[model samples]
Target: MAVMTMEQSTSRSILPAAFRTAGVDALAMIVAMVLAALAIYLFGNAAMQRVVTYAAIMLTAVLGLQIFSGNTGIVSFGHAAFVGLGAYATGILTMPAALQRTALRDLPQFLAGHEMSFFTALVVVLVLAMLVGLVTGIPLFRLSGSSASIATLALLIIVYTLLVAGREITRGSQPFYGVPREIGLWTAVGVAAMAIILARLFRETSFGLATRAAADDERGAAAVGVDHRVARLAAWVLGAVAAAAAGAMMAQFLGAFSPKDFYFDFGFTMLAMLIVGGMTSSLGAFAGVVVTVLVVEVVRRFEGGGVIFGLQMPVLFGLTQGVLAVAMILVIWRRPAGLFGDRELNLLRRPNAKMDPVKPATDVAPTRAAAGPISVDHLSRRYAGVVAVDDVTLSFEPDSITGIIGPNGAGKTTLLNMIAGDVMPSSGIVRIGAPVRQASAFRFARAGIARTFQNIRVFPRMTVLENVVVAARVVEPGLAAAEAAARRELARMGLERFADRPAASLAYGQRRRLEVARALALKPRFLLLDEPAAGMNAVETAELVSILAAVRSERRIGVILIEHDMRLVMNLCERIVVVDRGRVIADGAPAEVQNNPAVVAAYLGSRTARARQGNDVQ
Candidate 1:
């Protein structure tokens, strides 16, 4: 019963409320990183300093993994290849003259003669890794779940094979030496800090928000106009860059390494750090790195028989590996969401903040005049031997509500899906102002066509307002404007009360209204609703009808509604289209379609000749 007004959702600033809040989280991270660096520099011994540097490098790599895997909820095992690429690229470009002359006799002519500074080497490798990420991510990221994981593992094997086979470049399994030991404690710390900031900032960006939305639900995000491939690719490239930079630093730190250095061992360790701390938060990644480094150091000391106080600790066989394995297991078993989950570190709250009542949108909203009427010309869809929608032709007028009604197994949903670009029409054209050149969900949405799924597809992890904001941003230029638009739309749907709540937390009816609000946020020319009133009760149905009427009247947008509720359709629609099996049977006013003989026969079965004539009809 509590509603979040516009004033409550935003403050007097150009930045959106969400971004403003993220600034505080960023500050917390900055403070923690600076303090940790200071502590290492002031009190640590030489061994401690080296350990800190190594930990920082690991943190950078883990943060990279966090960006792609954590945000997109897709695990990647190929970042190890990126690490190797960075290390090998740096080594090849900076090998000492003597070593290069002796070991790289058959190396590439340009590479054999070059020796670059550490900074220059780092940049080159970073760019190279990102390029690799872009090329591989296009096809690899297209797969999801285990398929994507397997593809990434295949990439690791491919890179390993290339490194092992390229004797001239990588020395063919022999250690590549003569790399400059340039990554000191302070340099590693500085790079790690910068990487952390970049990782955290990316997560707060609008693109990041959209990527997370798509991760939560693909169909839902596409309906809101999110392009999944583009978002995923962007993250993948950035992540590769981070991992590459870390690898370059590690190369300089170790001074010599083999292909095995950047293989399964390194990749799994980074993944474990990410998962144990929390994959979704930058703070979690940082914490995981710190915890794992300490654990490994302690175990390493025990492995070599360290003297503690007056006692001698005997050497232990495989203790470090066993401890790390057990820790990873316990972490996964107890907290799958990670220690911090998706929360950021924040220390203070402004208790004096007030929630002011907001005025509903009057004429402040911008107009979407270019979105004209939509026309479907002979749209047909066939699956194998069955025709889901056969030669369906319909034109939805501007500022009007058209309802599609049919019995079970009819083509209503299929036809709607085709128009929304979720399903491709076997043969026909869908013209929205102009003939759609391509039938894609995002393209259709960009062309001012928005839709809601038959089954609700709200981003379960995102807040109700965020769900609308993601869609609104497709049309609005700025995040601030999108937030404003989303708030207004929520208010219009009476969803303002649940604005701050998670979309998954809302009641079933509220989720339906949230979907409508999300669709409207696109400023669409045509709004397609597929059984929007599917599970609603009498009162909810009436309210939905009113809302649709308001949307059509206020926005001057055409609406195509697919509904099974006869009363709701009969009362709310101005024009009705009826379909039987896969073809349109009747189209006219509600009353005419309701009494059509074909409609009756489709829904209630055909009548006998005597019954039709009303002569002693049984």
Candidate 2:
């Protein structure tokens, strides 16, 4: 027995770090829930046991929502539709043939004649829910923000309407009876436990991490090669499966339910539980369900006119909903992120050891073996008739460091943006290995181009290591390899010490370096940096120059920089392109550009003139 235990421990230690953490979190949650259920079963009456079962079913449903909405930061008001579908499907499939003939007389012959066991019926319901989610999500995921949320609300209304009108299938707003009450307290708890585990595991996967990165900052995620819509769609399908499972369990628990059971009121209650507890973690889903269930039980005792403090009270029709609404408002007001705010219950786990910084591989190669020079031909961009990049032509080789020095509004960043596929050119061609048309930033990133924004854009809520891991996972095959690559980049940028900390906690200079590290993880053929040194002190700027020079030499990849600091530009760049008023004024070696009359007039100005006069005086 000891030998078997040792083998199991050794095997578990080799799993990816993220999965291991998630496993521990899931175990902790399951233990807590089992203990609570045990107490209820041992001491509580039958009524309390039924309430616990109901709460367990609700927990499963809410966790399903967290899998999609929490990771993608998209509020979904339509998930309850899947829950309703699950109930109807389960009732139709599992009801006794005699009962089905009487209750759903017009149901399809195939469905009316079936009497499936609980587990078999659940499988069929889940598949139906997944198909439905896939069809609806194709178009809905295309829209984002408030628009996507409102679209979900519309979906709920549509599903509700269908259920009410489809008398043959759903009994038309009447109770769907005859589903066997096979799900007792233990069965419901078992399903909820599975949901909690699945939710935690999914959050540690590449899809969940990428979706979360997009939620933090879409532009940043794009630079790391994440397609937000695709990621969200995957989450939506899985969430639908979970909701359907919960709905099946609920149907058995009730033995009868109607479309109204899963409509507006139920939807609001599920969302309130999520919002009030926290939406970002599985622990929050658990906490929210527990709190909401307790509130409902207490409020129900007095809602129908009960003696309180030895006095008679009047009946209150909507007291439960009104109180829940106020509770949600108070929680949102006091803690906008909810009670636990992305934190998990990890009391049962041991503290993790500090990760040792790994040296970057010496033979790291660019993403493409023969990625040619990036060329821009007669590119121009206009904003309301005002030219931002005017008829610019430039070529950047894959084995050189070039600096683009220009005054503010001189269009250096605009040209960079066009090359990186963040902005469209008014009329021109951009060839990164080949001429491209209408490419998005993520596509450009996947095609051997990576860039840093003019304004620093890091995933603030993600760990410093996770920000790099998000980029690494784009190219690496698995989470373990991604984490290894991320550690290498963090070590290269001297950010390994802070790897476990949230990116938002980093200093301005550190965040700037963090962005560069994230870009490097993509292994791009061309690195475009915009104002990387803007907020850095002299020491940090000098360090950045050293790092950039080393990276360009070691990787043999093209580096195009836009900077206002003349000293750093002159020292680090092998070639300089000087621009003034959206036009290239001079393009040559640093010494030649420094002496050019046009360049001096446009940029160097009084500072260069004064320094020269002092040199002559000395």
Candidate 3:
């Protein structure tokens, strides 16, 4: 049994042992979900059920936020917009005929005349939320951090205003009552289940890995062929659907709703839960929901929505939100990572995981029967009028190791960036022979163009094994399966001994090796190592070479070695491409390239220096 060390920014996952079975955690999840459903079914009046349904709705909605904002380390304040759209869409489209006669009289012409079943309306609203995200994401796509946050707020305001001011369609800003409470307990549970499934699956997917990587360092992720925008957009749409589902469910629970329901207060509350629970884990979101909801329930039971603190007024109009606010502040001050950080919770109590041995990968020797060689045709990249790569063309044969070497400003990294599709070439095409079709950074890993960086970019807070597993996520099916595959990669890199150790805690050389392990997990056809030998001693560098050799032999994956350490490059590469100021100066075997005057000038400034370094190095 393989396992990652207990660490933040990662989880311990396992493959399905038999019949594609769920693990202890998954079974526990199933049991808990079933129990909650049963409790809602057996006990409780219509009102209690309504309360539970509301809680579930909030849980589902916040789960969406956690997926992108929490798990992926990006913040989005635009979630409420999604909820608002879903509610109005569902309300306007599915309002009961009897109530629609009076309530929707002033509604917009389009929705006023049209009505659909509650289920149909629900699905439609979810889709509508996605459409809204897609339509609006164009402007907000390139943003991150504070700028992205402000844009999200803008999105929220725009949607809120549209719902409120569009009187003809929304009954705008006015209270929308007489909405038949048709959302049943079972239905809400089903939706919550769906939300959990989606969140769980995505978090466990390769897309989720890329999302996290991109969040940690955009440039590094792009160099590895992960598209920054597309991954984020997918997260946005998924979040929108979940938010819409929550809103639609809320409308059914309330039996009526208004524009104010989709206000900043709601956003704040969800954000609070997201923060208090732990920003990047699904468990954190759900944990926050549990804590927040419990606080509210207790407060309402005692203070009746207000807390008794000496002579002052109640803590909250309703204790649920007010106490939750206090808790949020307290939690943020103390434990900012939230409940589990990036770790996932399983059924069994966790273990001392760092020392665990490795498990088996899906395939012993991952063969790329499809993709042939990767070719770069006259690739050029320019940034702000500066040519980063100029008319550089290179080819990486399948099952062969090649090296790209140059001085700091010679455009070695730029050329790799262009090949990976991180920086779209100014003029030229990157073609992959055989099964690989076209060149896209996002599809590179699956197409066999996985890579590592000079500056380590593994999931820092995650365990060493988790870092490896994260890389294979794109190639495998789910978290469990990916973990199984990653174990093999980690073992190959001689990192199984520290599988559970935090990547951040590893020495610099260890982190570098983990980076290589991660790239290997991708089952890539072509692997690029960008200064993998940097900051390593002779022993570490030799270890890296051994790992590289093993990778080529085991997986038959092509490799692009980018390094300043000429010794390592000469020792590992079959063909070497030397670039000087973004143009290839020499291309041939290591010894031949070393003898080139141009290569020598670029690396050592002249032939004499090369001879000196060669003697010293030998």
Best by lDDT: 2
Candidates' TM-scores?
Answer: 0.90, 0.94, 0.79
lDDT of 1 by residue, 449-536 (tens): 8899888999988778889999988987678878888888888888876776668889999999999999999988889999999888
Model 3, 1-618: lDDT tens digits are 233233211433434321122134444554576687688679857667767777778888998897778645768888987887787777778777767878777654566645587888887887788887788776787887788888899989988888888876777778877666788777877888777767766764557767877777676665455676878888888888899889888876776778888888889888988888887876777778777877777667656433345554543455566777888888877887776666666433233554466554434555563477888878888888788888977777888899988877878887886676556678888886543234466666656677887668777766676566656666665666666677777777777778666677888888888888787777777888899989999998898888788767767778898887878888889999988878998999988987898776666574566688899999
Better of 2 and 3 by TM-score: 2
Provide backbone clash counts, one per model.
Answer: 0, 0, 19
Worst 10 residues of 3 by lDDT: 14-23
Candidates' lDDT values, in order? 0.83, 0.88, 0.74
All candidates in order of lDDT, best leading: 2, 1, 3
Best by TM-score: 2
Worst 10 residues of 2 by lDDT: 345-354
lDDT of 2 by residue, 472-586 (tens): 8888767877787788889889998888778999999999999999999998899999989999999999999999888888888899999989899999999999887788989
